[model samples]
Target: MDTVMQPDVLVIDDLQKHFGGLEIMRGVDLTIKQGERHALVGPNGAGKSTLFNLISGEHRPSGGRIYLRGQRISGLKPEQISRRGLTRSFQITNVFSRMSAFENIRIGVMARHGIRFNLYRRIKPMRAINDEAHALLQQVRLDHRADNLASDLTYSEQRALEIGMTLATGAEVILLDEPTAGMSRDETAYMVELIRQVTEGKTLMMVEHDMSVVFGLCDRISVLVYGRILATGTPEEIRSNQEVQSAYLGEEEEH
Candidate 1:
């Protein structure tokens, strides 16, 4: 009998990042499997955001490499990396405040299809683009709010609209930074379920602080401590790892 293996979707190999005198990422190594939801959990200043920036090309690495599928993306620009099928959302909600929810998502869909804005192009019909954008609005459960200005939606709806925009890019790998931050418990739960549905069949990597959200929504968890990954495993395995408990989870329990 032969065994099948899931291909690695994203690989971080001995990655390093430095800010002048301080070393923020020190030879970090991690892997994300295809079609899996992976979580990065650690205390503040653990370099989780730095790692994401490095991977997403918001910042270049001081050393080492990042691979998407099997291609090197270490030094690529952010837009370049995004064109190659990776996109990310910020910790703060990022949406066009003046644009309606439908229009906000339509911009991303246009980007995905290489439709650049031009004064002459504006007069051309975009029925396909409009339909796709409306479908994405429905996917994120904001179809009712599609006509509303992004600034007018509730905080949770704004976040949902942002996620829809991220998806409109047709990214195979989605990195969400603190997607549930600053939400009430009900909003957090709604976001979690929304994420689960929208990220189906795509790769997701998120930096999250809420333990219940992390444990419930992710298939695998990576414990990053002091700029290094201490453990990576299934939720149950991470729950039982002594070093992980002492290094991060136990501290989380205390707070």
Candidate 2:
């Protein structure tokens, strides 16, 4: 009998990034598999967010290669990478502050279809786009607040709206940066559940600091230290590994 293996969705091969005299990513290698929820956990100054920027095209890699579904994507513009079905959310809540929640999501849907907004057109309303946006609003549990301005939503609701916008692009691979930062414990719990639900059937990679959220929601965890990965394993394995205890988790427990 033979076992089936999941295909790799994203691969980082000896990835490196340098800022003038400083090296932020030092010969890093990582892989994300299809339909798996993966978490990147590390301490401050460990280059977690920098790695996300490189993958999402905010910063070009100084060396090495990045593959999305086996095609090289390094050096492409953010929109170019996004059009390839990979999109990311920032640590900050990014939304149209003045627009209604419905409008914010509709913008992303329009981008997905390559339709430009023309304020002067005498055209029929796009029922399909509207319907999809409404459905996405429902999916992120923001349908009830669909008509409210984005600025009026609560912090958690605003975060949920951002996730809805991320999904509106029809992305297959999603990168979420610190999705639970600055949330109360209850808010964090709510967010973890919402992330678990919405990311169903999608591949997700996130940089998170909360161990509970990482352990409770992710299928695998990668511990990065000083700009490189130290260990990658299941929650139980990460919890029990002696090296992980000394390098990261043990310090987490002490603080």
Candidate 3:
């Protein structure tokens, strides 16, 4: 028998949301391919975050559906979605401020291994978790800060630590919200490389405002405006889309 493959890792169809009488997401639709880096960009309050919240199961949608590998996920919990190989990073730093970098990552590693409060099962497995935590810290270039408190590191280092936790989940489909939202040009460049390295061979969907990051890192771009996708294409195509340029990109440059 021949094997069939799932070409799309994520699918959003007619996704809508309502807060009282106000409509937030107006039947938005998007598709992300397996092992592809996709970007979602628009102005500041164009429902990007709302869409992410709906997909990540932070908020339930009023209508429509989301699918991961053809199975519906719109109504699933965040943990349930994560268990299905999808995970999300927040816009704000979400590390445990008082914990050491090593300890924070070890918690995530434990989550990945489904290690709950079972003391009898914890002894021998802890060494392996520690090793994995160190490896993840190295990948994010924060190994030197392993013993430091999360609150003690620079802003950039803290963001890198968050990425390490995301990796520790062992999620194959990752959703990142503004990974480089607040960074100097140099810091942005370093994060660009870290994101590229850590998310390699995994499906990634990022909502970002930085055009340079979008154009530089994403395989395809989806422009969301007024709670709907205006266009989806390669970098060059989106750049030249007169509709896209006039509706969003051109306006973004003026600021």
**Cα-based lDDT for every prediction:** 0.92, 0.92, 0.90
Tens-place lDDT digits, model 1, residues 57-136: 99999999999999999999999999999999999898999999999999999889977755566522778898899899
Model 2 TM-score relative to the real fold: 0.95
Candidate ranking under lDDT, highest first, comes to 1, 2, 3
lDDT of 2 by residue, 1-255 (tens): 010167899999999999998988998899989999999999999999999999999999999999999999999999999999999998999899999999999989987887776677542477888999999999999999999999999999999998999999999999999999999999999999999999999999999999999999998999999889999888898999899899999998898
In each prediction, how many residue pairs overlap at the backbone (N, C-alpha, C within less than 3 A)? 0, 0, 0
**TM of each candidate vs. truth:** 0.96, 0.95, 0.95
lDDT of 3 by residue, 65-119 (tens): 9999999999999989988888888899999999999888888888788876767
Per-residue lDDT, model 2, residue 249, is 91
Error of 3 at 5 (Å): 10
Q: Pick the candidate with the highest TM-score.
A: 1
Candidate 2 collision pairs: none
Worst 10 residues of 1 by lDDT: 1-10
